[model samples]
Structure formats: structure tokens, C-alpha cells
Target: MENNKGKSEWVSQQNYSESQSTPYCITRRYGSLTFEETVQNVKNGIKKLGLDLVGEFDVREYLSSDMEKMPRHLILMVCEKETALKLISNDIQMSVLFPCNVTIKEVENNTIIEVSIEDTDSTWSSAKKKEIIEVAKNTKNILKKLLDTIEQQNVKL
Candidate 1:
């Protein structure tokens, strides 16, 4: 992933900043779009990949009431019906992790936008059910493809 300078800024694809409460597997990729463009691109990418865009939240605006001008940040809640069904059927407890999240954030003083996806894998690593494992793997793959779509959207400039 290259920034506008043509310098590679892709730091890590693993959940290197993981904590117990934030075990949700996450991976990020920097793109050539600004904050607003990346946000819209995420929505389009989600639909283009046939994933459900169930919810959206503007974190920046939500916190602006109390804080000063903040960098743009948004979260898109996405899910696949059949995948959700498979996960819950295999393990009802997995319902808590339903509707995976895709986050678009502006960083470097709002000069750069990074897109991240909260994959379903490793989030519920306790599952012993084969069906549940398969669902997680499949969901993660779908989300990875979505990330790729978002990254490749504005290939030049």
C-alpha cells in the first residue's frame, strides 16, 4: 500500500496491537483516497462484494460535540446472511460477533486514509465445531477480498 508519495506505508497485516478486549482480528491497508473518498469506497466495495452493509457510524462527528476538530473516522457494519446463519447454527454463542466491521480512518493529521477490516477468524477461536471454523474461515476470506477491492479502487492518484 503506497501513500501519495509513492512510499510504501503498509506497516502490518496482522493484529499486532491486539489486547484481550480487542481480540477481533484486524488488518489495515493504506490507499490513495482521502477520508471522504475512502469512506464511500468502503460502502461501494462492500456492496460490490455482495456483503450486507447493515450499519454505519461517523465516529468523528459523534465525538466532535465534546472535542475539537477531529480527523474523519467511520465504521461500516457488514455481514452475510448465509454466513451469519452458518456461524450461529454451529454455535449460538457466536451471535455476539455478528455483523463484522469495516473501519475507514483518517490519520497523519488527516492527510492519509487507512481502511481496516475486522475479520471473523480468531475472534471466536474457542469454537470446537467444524462448521463454526469453516464459517469463520469463509467470512475472513470474504472480508479480505473486500479490503483488496477497497485498496485497488483508486489505483492512480
Candidate 2:
């Protein structure tokens, strides 16, 4: 698939090698911002996009109690109530994947943001599958926009 410049890429399980079986996740790399700044930008973008900031967990901070050392990493939970309700109303099992997850972690000189997409595989009706795909696609697009906005803002800074 052709990737747009400076945008997060959707990585489905099909994209992985046979040995790997991870679910789909969208990832983007930010080269111009620090971990804190990147997190802030993401928060701002989420609000601008009308998504709720459910919570943010600082992984590194949580692990510090165990004397474990790691680069700055955060997991942000965001969701749109209407979309979530529609999705669940279509498939109750989808509740396990509710409240989308976005991870930001420091890597070398850049910060990597990863957003997990709902698994669309199931024995649901064709129409149900279509609804799930549509919701996932819309969610992915919003995340891509959020990342793009952050990049653009950093460029202007």
C-alpha cells in the first residue's frame, strides 16, 4: 500500500511474517519532538478531533517502582462515544476492544506512536463486518489526522 508522507501506517496481521501474529496497529514516528511534547501534542489533537481522553498511563513511571529502567513511554486511551456505541450495538463481543489504545514510546532519537485497531475477523454477517471495517477505518483516519496535525505543528515551532 502507498503511504502518505508523515502519516501513520496501518499494520495488519497480514503484513507480518509467518512467525509473528500480532494484531493491527497504526504506528507513526515523530522526529522533532521530545516525549513530553509529543504526548502533549497528541492530547491536544485528540481534543481537537472531539475524542475523549479516557486516561494516560506513564509506563516508565509505573515501572520505576521496580527499579526497571526504560525510555519514556505512555499509553493513551481515547474514544468517541457515538462510534463506540454503534460498534458495540453491532457486536457485543467488541467490548473487549473498546476505548482505543495509543502508545507513545521514545526510540533512539525519535518517539514512536502506536495505535491499535480492532480486529475485524469474526463469524459475523457481511453487513456487520462492513460496519466493523467502517468504524475501524474511520478511527484509523482520525488517528492519522492527529499525527499529521502534530507533525505540522512541530514543523512550524
Q: Which pairs of residues have clashing backbones in candidate 1?
A: none
Model 1 vs truth, CA RMSD: 9.3
Whole-model lDDT for model 1 versus the true structure? 0.72
lDDT of each: 0.72, 0.64
Clashes of 2: 0
> Which runs in model 1 stand beyond 4 Å of their true positions?
1-23
In candidate 2, where is summed lDDT lowest over 10 consecutive residues?
11-20
- Summarize candidate 1's per-residue lDDT along 82-139 as a digit string, tens digits: 9888888888888898788787776655566767777567876678778887888888
Candidate 2 TM-score over all chains jointly:
0.71
CA-only RMSD, every prediction: 9.3, 10.2
Please give the lDDT score at residue 34 for candidate 2.
72
**Which candidate comes out best when scored by lDDT?**
1
Clashes of each: 0, 0
**Worst 10-residue lDDT window, candidate 1:** 11-20
